[model samples]
Target: MRHAIGLKIGPVAFRVGSDWAGPIAALADLYRDYPPPTGVPDYTVRLEAARPWRRWIRPSVTVRGDHMLPDALPLDLAHGVLAAEIGMNLQLALGERRWLLLHASSVERDGRALIMSGESGSGKSTLAAVLATRGWRLMGDEFALIDLATGAARAFPRATSLKNGAIDEMLRHVPDARFGAALTGTPKGRLRHLRPDAQAIARMDAPAIPALILFPQFGRPEAAEAMGPAETFVRLTQASTNYVPLGRAGYDALTRLVTAVPTVAVDYPDTDTAVGMVEQLWAALP
Candidate 1:
């Protein structure tokens, strides 16, 4: 841990340390606009060589922090940026308790938030990134933080992780300066990190009411369906990382969210169609 950087994204603060300066430098550049934590960081992520000898020969980064998966595999030095990102996510997923965390992507418009959650291949991240560029505020792409007391969605707008074709699509719309280098050979295939716009970073502290909950699936025939409250509750419980641990507080927060927000399931073959469908849905919101 020779080099380190502290960053505050929304309400969470993280201190990322690395044995090598490369990862730390990359993070500093990417999160340059973000502010430092007010005081002590909420979490600390360490990137170190798996073994002391490995530091000099064929170095690899082992993600270590307050919460870690013992069996988690190390990443090559080239992918250290991604390793750092994953490390921060690990700490939040395992340790955060102040907010009800949802494994989803979120965007906001006119004080209303849209929450999109689905399986691995779902287009939530890509969709959120696209919407952010089209006048919507990017709340977050990895984890959507929900205030347990007010039922509002707070911004956690970290870099948007774009995978496979989504990266190229985003490149077509966004400028080069907004993207990280294309990361190849990732476990999830070709990936790139898209930095949220300055507007998103500037308004990171603003919270929006949860107005829509969407379960989106890409590469499917275009269709939209209303979801029942029972099914939505079950699926959301699965989507949440610390739902059971939070017990009644988590349950009540989630219950209020599902009850208050409109839920929909969308299937689309392409991004344009999906965008159109989402626009139509938004227009019809009561």
Candidate 2:
């Protein structure tokens, strides 16, 4: 708990403390553009050594804080930045109750939002990043927050985690983007972090009305199918980490979202084609 930093990303604030300086420094560099969080943070994440000797010899970092997994494994110090990121995700996923959390990515155009939800390898993150470059505001990465009081899509544009090939793809398009070092041998494999565009950071607090929802799947022939409310509701509930915890408020909010917004499932063979499909879909929205 020696080296630490506070971050304000949209509706959430995080205070991450580390036993070593490297992780904190790395995180600070990645989130340099963000404003320092004021007042008490919504969640606290701690990076600690397994034992006293571990800090000095063969250093390792264990994620701990307000909410923790009982059997979470330790991560090598070399991947401390990832550890910190994972720690923040843990706290947010487990502790957040203010907004209805969806494991999705989002972008905005013309003051309305486009949310893409899918499982790992679905290309949602890459799609969001690509869309951000093609004239869409990056509203969020990894999670999409829906305000319970108002059925609006709040921006939570944290640094986007680009894995393996994604790192190269993003680098090519976002030439001036600031990126964290590629950390190899992690569970998800050679992942790097990309800071959100300046526009995303500057408008972190802005909220957009949800206009479209797309479930994108990668490695398939291009196709699009509309998802009925029943299926969309189930899929969204599965994606949300805090749906059940929010109870009736969560139910009402999600129902409003599903009924008011149309949902689609799209398949694409690559990023370029995916972008085209998304734009076409966006244009078709009524």
Q: Which regions of candidate 2 fall more than 4 Å away from where they truly are?
A: none
Clash number for each model: 0, 0
Report the C-alpha displacement of residue 190, candidate 1, in angstroms.
1.3
lDDT of 1 by residue, 1-286 (tens): 6899998998889999999999998888788777767899999999999999888899999999999998999998988899999999999899999999999999999999999999877999999988887899999998999899999999899988888999888888899898887889987789888888988999999999999999999999999999988899999999999999999999999999999999999999988898899899999999
Summarize candidate 2's per-residue lDDT along 1-286 as a digit string, tens digits: 6898998999899999988999999998999989898999989999999898899899999999999999999999999999988898899899999999999999998889999999988989999999898889999888999999998999889899989888888887887447878899998998999889889998889999999999999999999999998999999999999999999999999999999999999999989999999989888889
Give the poorly placed runs of model 1, Cα more than 4 Å off.
Answer: none
Worst 10 residues of 1 by lDDT: 29-38
Give RMSD (Å) of candidate 2 vs. truth: 0.9
**Where does candidate 1 clash, by residue pair?**
none
**lDDT of all predictions:** 0.91, 0.92
Worst 10 residues of 2 by lDDT: 172-181
